[model samples]
Target: MPRLADIDEISSLVLFVASDDAGYSTGVEFVADGGNLLGPVPAAKS
Candidate 1:
């Protein structure tokens, strides 16, 4: 499982999103949930 992301990690995204470098970034859909959309993993049977 992926570990929790640091504040800096998220802050970096915010910074970039706010910067002019991302001026062309329209309708951006950022997903920083460590791949939560992949759904839960199944448990292994012993």
Candidate 2:
């Protein structure tokens, strides 16, 4: 199972994005998943 991200970790990202520091940031997608989409190493075979 993939380890879930801590609330603090996600919160920090949100805060950064909402802050003035991220003013120049645009057209971005923040993938907060803990590599869950990757599944097992080498990936699963059909």
Per-candidate local distance difference test: 0.87, 0.84
Model 2 segments beyond 4 Å from truth?
42-46
Which stretches of candidate 1 lie above 4 Å from their native place? 41-46
| Per-candidate count of clashing residue pairs (backbone under 3 Å) | 0, 0
What are the TM-scores, per candidate, against the unseen true structure?
A: 0.70, 0.69
Residue 30 local lDDT, model 2: 78
Q: Residues 4-29, candidate 1: write the lDDT tens digits.
A: 98899899999999999998987989
**Residue 40 in model 1: lDDT:** 86
Question: Which TM-score value belongs to model 2?
Answer: 0.69
Where does candidate 1 clash, by residue pair? none
> Each prediction's Cα RMSD?
2.6, 4.2
Find the 10 residues in a row with the least total lDDT in model 1. 1-10
- Candidate 2 steric clashes: 0
Candidate 2 colliding pairs: none
